[model samples]
Target chain A: MTLTKQKNQLPVFKKMSTQPWSLLAPLLIVLLGLFLYPIIEVIRYSFTNLRFGRIEYAYTLHSFKSVFTDRNFLDMVRITFTFVIFSVTFQLINGFIVAFAIYIGEKLKLKGSVFVRTSVIISMAIPGIIIGVIWRMMLDESPTGILNYYLSLFGFGPVRFLTDPKIALISVIIANIWRGTANNMILLYAGLKTIPESILEAADVDGAGSFRKVFSIIIPSISPVLMICGLLSIIGTFNTFDMIMSLTGGGPAGATEVLALSSYKEIFVNYSLGKGSAIAAIILLINIIMAMIYFNMNKKVEV
Target chain B: MKNKKTRGKKVLIYAIYILTAIFFLFPLFWTLCLSMKTVPELFQVPPKILPKTIHFNNYIHIIKNTLVLKYLKNTFVLVGATAFGTLLISIPAAYAFSRNKFRIKNNMMFGLLIFQMISPLVIAIPLYSYLAKLGLLNNYLILIMIYIALRVPFTTWYITGYMNTIPKELDQAAKVDGCSRIRIIMSIIMPVCVPGIISSIIINAMSAWSQFIIPFILVDKGEKLPLSVGIINLQSTSEAITTHYLAAACMISVIPMVLLYIIFQKFIVSTISGSVKG
Candidate 1:
């Protein structure tokens, strides 16, 4: 029934027509005005000395020079990469484990798989700022802190989870992993479900152990998903500031300040519009590069 | 021996499930526990594992005295406008993508993907300039516009995917019967993809709820702040805040989203899986 209608419709598209533009016009206008134009402005503003609230400005490379030469920017690059690498690495590993567990539970008809899935997904619904707040509460560094209290029971001192510069970034990364694992799990689990069950069943019949089956079969087949999850985690974690902002506000001598937060602080806190725009332009550049890779990699990208 | 081994495997699976639940759910549970405690209990020598009695006062104070309601109102305005505006623009664009012949279709879809990948915080700088220039500071209209624009790219892509799943005959028959383009989309395409549309709206609303950097930068007025921003300022500024009160406020802010997920959990899961696969 549907094939006939598709047949009737396909020929009309053999030649380009302006008919679709009418429907596409609104979205096109928005992209141009909001997405495209502002991006150009960010680029333009990056090359100038445009401070906020002072109309007088000139086009120069001072902002770019300062941003590149600044010691803080170098530190931020190192910190940002550390955060992204650790967050992405752990999110993938844990996300896969959770997805694998759910898959196994389903195969064996476990009763509580749905409940476990719900608990994991619950984190996704909570706002990022709230996640930071709750983490702060949980990570209170005093002796009475919930995490620290538990640690004391295990013969450890009260650890400064957020205050100590060395541990602060690690704490932020942990919170990020918690926030991100749900997305990775959803994606990985979907990929797992697609691995022709026949293959796994065949492995079972061949007397394959669970560990060997995962290594020899499941991991290889789902390598595409695993790569995508890692890429997305890096990009997403790199761009995030809310969780870090509310959690630590890039504090404890700025140990946790990543590039995204630096851009925000430059513009809003420090009032250096040119420098902020320069940082933002760099961010846009990185995002575009990563997104281009994603576009090419995504199976959905017909382009 | 085989039966005993299976029983042990079952125990292990249940153990994993229990541990996972505790890991994910404990913080929220901890907050709930904190919200019920008295001021004395909060700063006690060692924190009490549970409150002696549940306290409604913290919830009452935040609900009645604090900006929780105001923040809720502001968030509703922003989130609702985003969902509504995105749907209004994206549905037609999605219909166009799925049904019509277009030369730039692939390129446009790719452009949308790039925008989707770049988070709102990255664009906050550029949008900040526009907000300053237009003097839309503390205005819902500007927030709504930016949110809708950012969301249009994503929702359009997902909805287009949904429209692709639908049979062409459904809309073609409507067209042959002289149903206008608008009517065909509304009556035929939309009802068939209700779950898709609903899920798109839910996803848009979820992002809008989580938005902090944009609204935080633009809407600086105390009363104009959304829950996300308001709650942050509430935490940082007020040194005198008892722990229980803050927990109560946190609980209030998250409950709606939690409820929405519970009710539509299956719908959301299916829509997301379908969108990804399709």
Candidate 2:
């Protein structure tokens, strides 16, 4: 019946002419109108000193010059890089350990290990805004702070987790790591799952210790995944706005101020579209560079 | 002796897992615990580990006095429309990109990938001004359209990868059976790729639902604000800053996402891993 159906319908296949662009045009139009157009506008707007309410526009490179010359821009860059480095480091370490343990549990057929997986999922799905707000409550400087309550149980004094300039960036980093590690773990575990059991068994037969096997075998096999995760973590951390806004508001005198938050402040708060667009353009350049490297590495891995 | 040693290691690993779970989950657990406490309990010298009575009134109060419910409704409207629109556009695009051969296809996909990397905050200023010029600031249509654009690249990428896994033979077979391209896609590919479409929907829904800065700056009205912006607004206002009320609102905002995760946990995992593999 199927063979006859194909034979009878073969003529129709040649006669029907449907262009792929017809299907692709809607997405293309939206991307052009909304995505690419806005980006071009941002790049153009960055060159103009377009402050709100005074529309006598002077297109100049002053915004970029000021952003480059300002001491605060340097501080924001330092804070942003520092946050990304520390948070990604913590996430990688914690994610690896959890993923490894889960892999071991799967190998050993451990009962009740499903709960561990669920917990990780739960953590990953908790939205960043909630993470920021709840952490704010927990990190309150007063004794009422939950973290402070626990610290006092150990006879430690109440610490200004988000209030002090020195500790504010670290506090935000900790919150981000908490929110992000589980996602890293989930992805890493999936990568681990792809490794063939025969390789591990062969290593065991060769009397290779677990640590040696992990370093020599498992790590190399998953290095591509690691690279992808790291790049994504960097991008994701750089995009951190809601959390910073809710947690520290880039506060304690801009200690936790990242490029994203800086752009928000310059644009929305100060109504300096020129400066904001310049900073945003800087961010776009950084991301594009990172993505180019990612693509090159990814292609090599595929080959 | 060897068995005992391995058992000891296993026990140690489980202990570490449990300890980590506690450490990682503490914030959420604390939020839930705090939401059930009275205002006085919240301000107690050392916060009570368990509230003496589980105060149900916090939820009631937020529902009565705040825009929490309206915020949820607004979020659903925004996310639902974005998700539906994303699928509407992306499904056909993915089908074409996967099934048809065309010049500039790969370039288009790569362009979309680069667009994906550009965060909305980077373009927020220009977008805001443009929307203002068009008199569409605080407009639901503009915000939804933006959300759809923001999500389209990712949805297309994921769905195209999924469509590739579907055999071309099926398309050929359907075409020979006098079915048009649309018919083949809708009847055959769409049904087969439901999981992929769903994963895209859930991911888009979550991102759109939890989006902060776009809706924060774009929509000015309190009633129009999504849950994320609404909850933050609740916290920012001095009058609404009570711990229990904030906790309750936060919990309410997250429940739908949590339930979605519970239902589609595997799909989410597969999608993330799939991106890496791609």
Candidate 3:
């Protein structure tokens, strides 16, 4: 009907119809110049052999070959996987549980539900960088560190949270979990609310227990939200640079080194633009693939 | 028996809720506590839960000595420019995308989503060399421009969602009354979407203020560095006397955003959930 109406009105509105294109032009120009052009430049740079000024300025797959063959490449990949996977897992579970609490609190008209909601929202607003700074300080391997100080109360000695390689990656993951849970909570709670009340009520009338209702009704209903949230958590954690940079600097013998940081180091710290761009290209490829899956799932959810 | 079981379950839920809230909020409280502690108190064995004497001087010292104020100024400048630039650029684009029946509209919209997917780090190297060759490094304008580009797509996507909510009849009526599209967008749609616009501004401003990677790479000068980088340098800026001052500076930097979050809590949650839904 709208299409027929639009067709009928096209002759009369042709003059005014051009206005939208004009309005879209500015955003189109800015994005092309800054975002799109830079991406094209990055891809082109990745294939070339341009160092900070040591010959070999030719277009070849040398940088890509070297990146795949580099000794630390596999280790960086492993670290990146461990960080991304575990952080997303922990973040999703914690976020879901907290969101469930908020959902229940609202359902029961609990008094402090508002306060709990406010705290979660505020936590979401706290910058990742500040989260890094505060957690770094808290996880300091000294008695002064808050976590250590608390642990000492339980008869544990000071633990090297960031310095001990075994614990450093976990430490960053903990900080990320801290940074990410609120986001998880908000999305999951919103997801929970979207579950049809009739379905839930139907389950209740059939004598479904809480766990059964959750597994049978709630989980299936919110699975799309879960998928989107999980994917976002993974993507966000994978792109993590600020928090990791501050928290670990990818140190303790590079135990915390992730792809983004490796890209950062290769470009800025080492000034090897070719290798850095190559790493960035790979990170971009992974992100794009993950995002494609996310959007695919999202499309299904919307439908 | 059922009543007792339900009450016990409620109690358990509340317990978990309170514990999670405490876990989420402890960092903010801890930062505040540590900011008020003396160096001796900071290093005290087992650490003091509360300071015997509040060291207000830590806040005063960082403000007086370090580049804390300069960092604030630079950050405010970047945030202000990016927010304004984004609004100026995105509002029109959102207006067009939402109100118009242009060809390639769906493709452009999908492109915006793809743009959001790409991380800034992916293009960091090329952007660095490009800006460096242009002599734009270490400048607030370069960082702001990049930030505006980084945020504009999401902001535009957000505003477009808001614009789609306004009934098309208003635009139709305005157009019949011979009002131009721009005027309709400004006079009609803009007022209705004020809450969304404010949320967009607040969210973008906070993200811009907290942004690290762009400023970290783009700006090399000490004076030009934003708080995100400067606060990290607090440790290296002073070897032995770092902890209290770092805490103090961090508290100062974070309080504004916390305050904004408190004031705009409803809008923030709604905006996020809206984006997630999309």
Q: Pick the candidate with the highest lDDT.
A: 1
lDDT of 3 by residue, B18-43 (tens): 89878878888888888898878877
| Over 4 Å off, model 2 | A1-18, B276-278
Cα DockQ of the candidate 1 complex: 0.55
Q: How close is candidate 1 to the true structure, as a TM-score?
A: 0.95
User: Docking category for candidate 2?
Assistant: medium
Global lDDT of each model?
0.84, 0.84, 0.83
Docking outcome class, model 1: medium
**Native-referenced DockQ of model 2:** 0.52
TM-score for each of the candidates: 0.95, 0.95, 0.95
i-RMS of candidate 3: 3.6
Query: Relative to the unseen true structure, what is the C-alpha lDDT of residue A223 in candidate 2, on a scale of 0 to 100?
Result: 86
Q: Model 1: how far is A174 from its true place, Å?
A: 0.9
DockQ of each: 0.55, 0.52, 0.57
Q: How accurate locally is residue A35 in candidate 2, as Cα lDDT from 0 to 100?
A: 82
* Tens-digit lDDT string for candidate 2 (B1-278): 77986898699779868977887777888888888988788889867777788668889988999988999999999989999999999999988878665567777777777878778886567778878878888899989988999999889977887887776677887777788788888999999999888889888998898888888888888888989999889988948468889999989987788889888988888887774542
Model 3 bad stretches (over 4 Å): A1-16, A53-56, B238-240, B275-278
lDDT of 1: 0.84
Q: How high is the TM-score of chain A in each model? A: 0.93, 0.92, 0.92
Cα lDDT tens digits, model 1, B190-238, are: 8998988889888888889988888988788899999999999889866
Candidate 2 C-alpha lDDT tens digits along A81-133: 99999999889888888888888887788865677777777876677888899
